[model samples]
Target: MDFQESKTKENLARSFAAECQEGARYQFMAKMAQQQGYQYMSMLIRTLAHNEMAHAQQFFNKIVELGGNQTQNIEITAGYPFKSGELLDVLKQEAENEHMSAESIYPKFADIARDEGFEDVANLFDMVSKVERTHERTLKKLHENLSCNCLYKCNDEHAFKCDECGTIIMNKCAPKTCPLCKMGQGYYRIDFSIN
Candidate 1:
């Protein structure tokens, strides 16, 4: 489908820029998480960054296939409430971004793509929207737990994956260090879904 002269092309271009920026943002967040000793969180965030890059690549390919070119420069401007120095504030802002993307932006883009007969793009948008929702939920929980000082003492035994050695462990609290890799508690990914 040659969507070069269509609104969908413009939308795709914009989405591509957003995805690229998101990838960079996630990478920055991942670095901050690692600096804060949240190794598992850092790993997860880096994975997300990679996913975002994949999304951007897909969008770029689709745009090119539709005969769109980057001969003309695009000026992108964006602003969010997150500051790099504050972890809690950044988490809240990221959650808010995910909520907006899942609830509004991605849904609208998916609808447009569907209407334009771009089923593949629509499906990708829908999948990304779902993932954004999950990210939003997780970030909210993390923010809440950190605020309440209950991240390590929630009395909830849930499965955790060691980010260092990929060992799965079921524990109510994060271990001081992974037995397999000798990594700290921050290297474990704990599930917060259980009450």
Candidate 2:
């Protein structure tokens, strides 16, 4: 069977396009966060953007492997989200989109790949879906914390570290601004790495 005629090939192309758009969207959100003085938050979003681009690269590699390196203008039509707003709204939109991708879109794509005898493609979709789930959870957690104004809070006395000046303070929540650097609360790292 010709790979070019397979659904998985089209799926790969679609995935690549979608991931590229997602990466760009995340990058824009990160830029907005940075402009609003959310240093640590911007960093986290940028990391997600990079991850999305890496996913795009993986899909592109697969496409190249199947169709050769030359430009193969495989015409494809797919619906994509255009959600943009304030930082909080953007975060929420990303979380919702990631959830949809992980729970609905990718699963169906994976099933199609499997049914079409493209086990490797199915595994790729599954793996990406798992990462998307993680992204959804992480972004949702961050969104909730930010919305509640407790991103830097803890139940017990915990050390809040400043990303700019490396200042550390033990308290239930971070200070309004870093004492050393005079940076705003956003400069305090939230350690979203664990989320």
Candidate 3:
């Protein structure tokens, strides 16, 4: 199938639409985190939002490379308004979203791209699907820890820095939030690594 053909074009446009939706979703989550006093978490989520934007740009660039149409792009529909709830509720929702993307959405897109001979796009889909799966696992772990009330049970010495107020705290785990700035524990960092 040619890149500009209907099936290929629809997939590219839909992929771009999905990327845009994911980007917006992350941004909304980041905003919510920031409002809830999770500064570091907000920052990390914002970084993720930026990454999603980059992915959308890549999809868009590919569509443009194949001479995408504005009308067709506008016609492409994608997005899901996430549910708002308590902390555990939010975590569960995110985990479910990640699972859907990893197990259903991306894999299907990857397969279609492969069949259409768009190896590069297929690779992108596969890579993103793997990342989504990892995210699902991490979210589930967080949910489990919170559910069991063991989020801050540690014997060895541990420390965390508040991303909002820059307060240094030494404890078994991060405080429920920064005592000084009231930033959520999500804003607390135990060990930040750079690659």
Identify the leading candidate in terms of TM-score. Answer: 2
Tens-digit per-residue lDDT, 1-195, candidate 1: 556545567777777887788788888888988898987777777887887788788878876665646435434454434356577877788888889988998899899888888888888789888988988897798789778866555466777767678777777776788888998888776654432
TM-scores of the candidates are 0.79, 0.90, 0.75
Better candidate by lDDT, 2 or 3: 2
Model 2: what TM-score?
0.90
lDDT of each: 0.76, 0.87, 0.71
Clash numbers, per candidate: 0, 0, 1
The best-first sequence of candidates by lDDT reads: 2, 1, 3
How many pairs of residues in model 2 come into backbone collision?
A: 0
Give the better candidate number (1 or 2) by TM-score.
2
Q: Write candidate 2's Cα lDDT for 1-195 as tens digits.
A: 467888888889999999999999999999998998788888889999999999999899888887786547888989999967888998999999999989998999999988988888889999999999999987998798889978889877777889888888878888998899999988896443333
Clashing pairs in 1: none
The RMSD of every model to the true structure, in order and in angstroms, is 3.5, 2.4, 3.8
lDDT by residue (1-195, candidate 3, tens digit) is 667664556666776776677778767777876786656556765776676677778777877776645435335566665587776787788789879988998899888888888888888888878877877886687678668865554556566677667787777788885689885677676643311
lDDT of 3 at 67: 62
